[model samples]
Each structure stands twice: as C-alpha cells, then as structure tokens.
Target chain A: MRYIASAVFVIGVFVIVTAVTTQHAAKLDPYMYDYMIENFEDDTHAKNAVAAILLDYRMYDTMFEALILLTAIIGMKQFLPGAADLRARDELESVDQTEATGEQSSERPSE
Target chain B: MSGPVSDTMPTDESIVLQMVVGLLYPFMLLFGFYVILNGHYTPGGGFQGGSVLASLFVARYVVYPVDDTDTETLHSIQRVFLALIVIAPSAVLFTGVIARNPEFRSLYLTTMDVLIGVQVGFGLGVAVLRFAFFQGVGKTWHL
Candidate 1:
C-alpha cells in the first residue's frame, strides 16, 4: 500500500511538472535572447554575452550548480565510513565532558 | 586509554626538515586559493584548486612524524574546519532559496571558491592526520 501510494505520488508530481513546463514552453519569448544581446553593453560590461548570462544575468543557475557540487561532497562524506567516524567523533568530543585523556587513538591505517 | 606514543625527541636535522615542510604547506595553500580566485577568468577552479591544497597536508604527514604538537590538535582543527567547509556552501544556497528572485540567480561562485578552499584544505588535513596517526612515518629517516 505504501509503495502504491508513493508511485502514485511520483506520477502525479511528474504529470503536474510536465503540464507546467508545457504551458511555459508555449509562451516562450523568442526575442528575449536577441534583446539581451542587443542591450548587453547598456546593462553589463561583459564582452561575452554567454559569460554575462551565466555569471551575471543568470547567476542563480551557477549558484545552484555550486550547490550541487556541495551536495555531492556532503553525500560523499556521509557515504564514506571513515568520514562518518570522524564526524561522529567530532560531535562526541564537542559534547562530552570527559577530560582529554593524554592518550590518542592510533592514526587510521593508510589505504 | 590509548597511551601516548613514546616522545622521541626529533633531532635538529629532522626538526629543520619538518619546519621546511610546514612552511611549504602554507605556500601550497596560497597557490590553491590563487587558482580558485582566478577561476572566473582562468582554467583552474575551486575543485581543482582545493584538491591541490589538500594534497599538501598529505605530503606533510608523509614527510614528518606524528608528534605531540602536530597530531590531536591538528586533527581536531581539521575536523572543525571541514565541518565549516560543509556548512558554508549550504548557507549560500539557503540564502538563494529564500531570496527567490524571479531569475533565481546568485552571486555564489565566489562563495563556492572560498568554501571549496576550506573543504579541500581541511579534508586533506584530516586525511593526512589520519594517515600519519595510523601509518607512522616513512622509511626515509631525516634525522
């Protein structure tokens, strides 16, 4: 029952997204790119329109791309057992009141 | 409690070598930042730059011994710095989500460069620390 509900929810979301995208597609402004190119110097000093588009005009996309990179790093850290241990140990050390024992754990064995 | 590793006083020559490696580490870090900062106009970017910086820490561990001054404190510092590295990029993204401009754009590349530098620096530091702690020093005795 849960699987069926999840499948339905996923399909429902897909359908809604497709519908919205199709609607937006139909109303696309073809001249917008041309207009931006024509007005490039007036608005931004970028020599390359594409660079301007990516860095300035559409910097949000670039930001999200960076976010994706960050997410991948976080995901990698989570998936790696050693990283997980380090994270856990760090958290424990911060919260625990135990005195810093002079002895230190042996360094992790090199791969 | 795991007992402290026997404090073998590094000879003057060994200390000199370690100091040289330590000094070099900062320059390597600076170079990594250079790559990241000039990424907008140049070929190298955050990811590449960060990895290069991180590798220096690994190099440091390989070249030096895990002494009292360099082990636990350095490892803890790396962990803390890496945590910040993991957080800084997300914070920028969160700000973007909340601002919700119709364009949905952000001035995040600079932030990305800084965060990647931290991540690479800290991540490498941790890895080197772990390596030094676990593997002990290499066969080449500097002293």
Candidate 2:
C-alpha cells in the first residue's frame, strides 16, 4: 500500500511537471540568455557570464547559498551521536535524581 | 535525516592502496584549488571549486574513516568563513556605493567566490564527519 501510494505520488508529480513545462511555458524566457550574454562583459566586468551572474549580479543568492550550506552542515552535525551525548547524559542523570527523590519522571530536568 | 549511523571506515591494512590513495589526495586538492583560483577567467566558479574542495574530505573519509578534525575546530573555521562570505559582499557593495570605485565591483565578485569556496569546503567536511562518527543527535547547534 505504501509503495502504491508513493508510485502514484511520483506519477502525479511527473504529470504536473510535464504539464507545466509545455512548449509555450518553456519558451517564455528564450531571448533572456542573448540579452545576458550581450551585456555580460560590459556590466559585470568578468570574462565569464556564469561567474558574473553567480558571483556579482545575483550576489544575494551567493549569501543565501552559504546560508543553505551552513544549514545543511549544522543539520548533519546535530544528528551525530556525539553531538547529543551531553544532553542525553544530563537527562539520564536528572532521571536518576528524580527516582531517588520519588518524584515523577514527567517533570523536566531543571538542573 | 536522523538515521542509524553506520561504521563505514575500513579496518583492513593495505599498504599499497593506502599509499596510492594518500598520494592522489594532495593532487586532487591542488586541482580543486586551481579550479577556484581560475573561476572567473575560465569555466569554474565557487560551487564547482567548492565541491572539488569538499570532495577531498569525502575522499579522505572513503580511504580512512578515522581521519577527521575535531568538531569544535571545524565549527570555528566554518563560522569564520560564514561570516566572511556573508560580510564581504556587503563591504564591497559599500565600497562601490560610497567610494564609487569601479574596480571594487569585479573585486566583490571574485572575493565572494573565494569566500564561498572556503565556507563550502569546511561545511561539507563537518557534515561528513558527523556522518562518519556517531556521538548522538541533539536538537541544538553547538556552533
């Protein structure tokens, strides 16, 4: 059942993508590339248009790109077992103290 | 994304293989740096060079799993790059606008490319380290 659901979902995505990228929609920005290439050296000062667009014209995107990479790095670090040991140890210690005091384990670890 | 971490480090001792891989590692890193350095004049740029640099860490991890830096130091280095990547553009823009220096415009682009390369390289290294070593998962960030 899960596999069937996933297959249907994927098929739906493919159909949606195909419909959205039809001939007219795909050709909307056809001349934009020519314009960019023409203005590349004059406005950007760099020999490469890819570099100009990526590094200068759309620089804000580069900053966001850094943010995205940092977020992914931080996300992966958070999942590492060593990263959580300190908090887990603290929680376990609090649980042990709660048991000794005959208090409910449901209570948060204040210490 | 949090799943059971697998021990992927090789425990075997292959002297020939290790030596060959070790030799290739430095050269690959040099090539990655070259890609970054020649980004504007050539075809490569920040992401391309950044991925090249990141692949060094990935390659080292593949060869020897135990070879990784401490997370604290990695975190500090990444933070520094992150700050620079974020701040340098603003500084350049300020120079371009305030000082009205035309040269700073191109400098701004090249500068960001270099900063992005460093930030991305270490960011991936940390991510790879986290995957290779399983200390546990926490909801908060240390860096």
Candidate 3:
C-alpha cells in the first residue's frame, strides 16, 4: 500500500510539472520588470531593489516570518524540557543521557 | 524569582584562542555599529548589524565560553529599544503630535534602524546565555 501511494504521488507530481505552461505568466507588458527595477528606488528611497519591494510592498510577509520565529522560540522555551532538568533536547531516544552539562550524549562530543 | 541564570565561563583557557578573539571582537563590534548607523545609506541594516553584534558574544563563548549575558538587563534594553522602535517613528509620522519637520521621515528610518539593532543584539544575547546555562557548562553568576 505504501509503495502504491508513493507511485501515485510521483505520478501526480510529474503530471503537475508537465502541465505548467508559461501562458499563465504571459504579461500584457513585457517591460514590467525593467520599469519596476528602475522606479522602485525613486518611490521607496531604498537603494536595494529587493529590499524596496519586500519592505515596501510586502512587509506583511516579513511580519509573518518574524511571527513564526518568535512563536517557535516561545514554544521551545515553554515546552523544551522540565525546569531544573538539564539535558540535550534530542537525547530522548538514548538510554544513557547527558545531563544539561552535556557531558555525554549520542550526538558528537564537539556539538 | 525566575531571573536569568548567571554562569561564569570555566577557568580552562587557551592563550591563542583568547588572543585571537580579543583582537577580533573589537573589530566585529565596530563593524556592527557601522552597519546599524549606516543602514539607511548602505547595504546593511538593523537586523544584519544586530546579528553581527550578537556573533561577538558567540565568538567569546567559543574562545572563553558562558553566554555570561545578564538576561534582566538584556530584557530591559530590548524593551527600551522596542519602545524606541515604535515611539520614534510615530512621533515623526504623526506630524501634529510633534513639530512637523521635513527631515523627520529619513531621521525616523535611521533611528528606527538603530533601535532595532540594539533590540536584536539584546535578544540574541539572551538566547546564547540561556543555551549556555541550560547546557550546564555555564558557571552561575556571582554577586
């Protein structure tokens, strides 16, 4: 069943890849990129075109990215392990655990 | 109180690593400050400069070790900067609230960048300190 599912997924991906055409991206005006590149600085005052576009036009996406980072950090702080308990986070599977001092663990010693 | 766990680095020392880090850390700090101050006109900005500054602490750890950062102070600094990030811009943006100055917009951006750099630096410092403390290599703070 797993193999059959994998085969179907591969076929679906192949069909999707083959079906995409440039017609969807065909712009009415081909000079849009040039125009945007030239004008972004004038409008936003940012020297970097990429920064101008991302920060000027699409700041919300960046906001979401920041939100994700904060959320992950907060989640880790809240749920990483018990208070007064010290150990590497990934040491759950090993029978011999390194204390939070990280004296011994399955991971490389240098790490 | 759930304050930061203060940990001093171990006495184990390497002269070569210490010397190199001592030499490099100052330059890294200067570059980080430059990035923050010049973000409006240059390629680097608040986040980049802040990360660069944060790297100094990590390097110190690699050479010496304990994310010996004081979390309480860091938290306060982050708060202050976060306030600056909001207040500085809004004061300029809402022209009627403060005297309307033509140059306020550009000033706002530059100041915001500075505040952001400070905040990011503090934040990353806190993270490194916590990691060291929890990892158990860090010596607890004295005094």
Candidate 1: where is the Cα deviation over 4 Å? A1-111, B1-8, B12-26, B67-107, B135-143
- The Cα error of candidate 1 at residue B81, in Å, is 7.2
Which predicted model would earn the best lDDT?
A: 2
Question: Runs in model 2 with CA error above 4 Å?
Answer: A1-16, A23-33, A83-111, B1-11, B94-99, B135-143
Supply DockQ values for each candidate. 0.04, 0.46, 0.13
- Pick by lDDT: 2 or 3, better one: 2
Candidate 1 RMSD to the correct structure = 13.5
* Candidate 3 structure, TM-score to reference: 0.61
Clashes of each: 5, 5, 5
Best by DockQ: 2
Model 3 lDDT, residue A21, Cα: 50
The best candidate by TM-score is 2
CA deviation > 4 Å runs, candidate 3: A1-111, B1-11, B94-100, B135-143
TM-score-superior candidate, 2 or 3: 2
**Native contacts recovered, in order, as a fraction for each?**
0.00, 0.84, 0.10
